[model samples]
Target: MKDGWIVNRAGLINFWYYDDEVFEFMDGRLLIRGANGSGKSVTMQSFIPLLLDGNKSPERLDPFGSRARKLEDYLLGEEALSQTNERTGYIYMEFKKQNTKNYLTIGMGLRARRGQPMDSWGFTLLDGRRVG
Candidate 1:
């Protein structure tokens, strides 16, 4: 039998929420139900850049190149920024590849500065205590 690929955990900080919130996925389908502007799309689309190879910009993420115009476009707002927090925003996902014996975690962080053209961002991958 082929191994199962499941999203073990996922979360974001400052992208949609001022604080961090994590989601643990069990063995089943995930259904995100919510009202308008409930951050449903924000939570689902948060993984696109982490799972796939990209510059983590809105235009790159948009295949049609018609949706987002800049990286700051995804930033929740100036209110989401904080002097206490080192990172302006970030998204992370942890999962096990099919049939694989190892667990992988990937994440991306954003830093936006006022009046700057673009936000400074970086990506990370972690397996156990090792980092890449």
Candidate 2:
């Protein structure tokens, strides 16, 4: 399969509690090492807001369950319902099969304001050709 960087993320929010953020991963394997509560899980949690319209707390039994609910509510507020911040960077993902040397790319971006409809952009490619 074609090998290349699949996902790119920048200006992440809850991921690390950092003011500004950038992260990229290829092939869907992420290697994170840091001190406890150093924001590793927080950084990962940032995506929950983006993926689920708003963030949903993980089941109470899950490690990050408490924060999940809090974050979800934060994202789904009445004025700013979008999970991702308008100023945050974008995320891109690509995939490849085990034996078939083929690749696909997916890209997405989000923009929202306190009183505006959230905006999104997405594109997909197969073998570097737009098929969907």
Candidate 3:
């Protein structure tokens, strides 16, 4: 039997260009290819450190490690796309046992209001449990 867990998928809901998107992986590998302004970076930045530890520091929101973006910017939308004063979103990654049906899932949920600081929560589920 294979000995360890492998990533099975990543999901985004109401985040960036995705109202709901699910990315499936093959043998723990996923290739995210898209055109410019197509949200490839946004998708990566939204997951990595955020899903890894639920940290929302501005620097973590950018792939360049610069504080050029904010979690609120994604939730409340940018000035031009600001259609709602408040919003919530979720990001998650799921892993499957190397040779079994068992699985583990981890995710972060973020909330933002136009004039309020952002808030977030992180969670983990085992035995294939999930939320989305």
Which candidate has the highest lDDT of all? 3
Better of 1 and 3 by TM-score: 3
Which ranges in model 2 have alpha carbons more than 4 Å from their true place?
Answer: 1-28, 46-63, 66-88, 99-101, 115-117, 129-132
Task: Give the residue spans of candidate 1 off by over 4 A.
Answer: 1-5, 49-51, 59-69, 76-87, 97-101, 119-121, 129-132
Give lDDT per model, in order: 0.60, 0.46, 0.83
Worst 10 residues of 2 by lDDT: 8-17
Candidate 1: tens digits of C-alpha lDDT, residues 35-128: 9878776666666653456456565554455554455655634434533322387777767655565566777777766466545555555544
Q: How accurate is candidate 3 locally (lDDT)?
A: 0.83
Error of 1 at 30 (Å): 2.5
Ten-residue region with minimum lDDT total, candidate 1 = 78-87
lDDT of each residue in 78-109, candidate 2, tens digit only: 33444544343344344555445566655555
lDDT of 2 at 101: 56
